[model samples]
Target: MSDKKALNFTNWDTTFDNGTSEDGSRNCVYMSESLDYKWVATSCVEKINFL
Candidate 1:
């Protein structure tokens, strides 16, 4: 058996609020454990630390 989690349902929307088009350009979702697990939309090219 593995220790990794199965899934987490934050029910966050995958919309870019930076006035950017959601045409697979800025299509990335991330959650910050430091910020009380808040969701943030970012670029797919960005380097982030995953939990």
Candidate 2:
């Protein structure tokens, strides 16, 4: 019989907030332990503007 390793899974809690501004500027925030929160924000904005 062949031996193999099972994949491991992680449980994470996340928080998101709408960063809408009064001037009609749209923004978003995401928080997770697996990644840098700031990076997520920057990446999201970049994607939105790119579209």
Candidate 3:
């Protein structure tokens, strides 16, 4: 029911991409060029360092 989605496979929870559930605690998602421009999810308060 939320916009939390993972465009790429993650070592963390997979529900973000499956849309099966919404993780209110971690509401941040971004695309990673290293992973072929796939999406990654994390906490909004955390800094995303990708190159």
Candidate 4:
């Protein structure tokens, strides 16, 4: 009989420039599936900071 294995998963968060005249923020999330990977990008203008 052949052996089977479960898929491995990972999560990541990062910030990037939005490349616009107005100040923009970008939030990204990534997931890996075997040799392939997928990502989601969100763009916003509002800023939130906590101190």
Q: Return the top candidate by lDDT.
A: 1
Where does candidate 4 stray beyond 4 Å?
Answer: 1-23, 28-37, 44-51
TM-score of 3: 0.42
Clash pairs (backbone) in predicted model 2:
none
In candidate 2, how many Å is residue 25 off? Answer: 8.3
C-alpha RMSD of candidate 1: 5.6
Q: For residues 8-39, could you state the per-residue lDDT of candidate 3 as single tens digits?
A: 64554333453323344556777766666666
In terms of lDDT, the poorest run of 10 residues in model 4 is: 12-21
Q: Give TM-scores for every candidate, taking all chains together and pairing residue i with residue i.
A: 0.48, 0.20, 0.42, 0.19
> Which lDDT tens digits does candidate 2 get at residues 1-51?
246667664433334333444444444434444554233332334334321
- The 0-to-1 C-alpha lDDT of every candidate, in the order given, reads 0.65, 0.40, 0.58, 0.40
- The per-candidate count of clashes, in order, stands at 0, 0, 0, 0
Candidate 1 lDDT, tens digit per residue, 1-51? 287877666755444364454455667768866556678777787789886
TM-score, cand. 4: 0.19
lDDT of 3: 0.58
Candidate 2 vs candidate 3: the lDDT winner is: 3
- List candidate 1 stretches off by more than 4 Å: 1-17, 21-24
Question: lDDT, candidate 1, residue 10?
Answer: 72
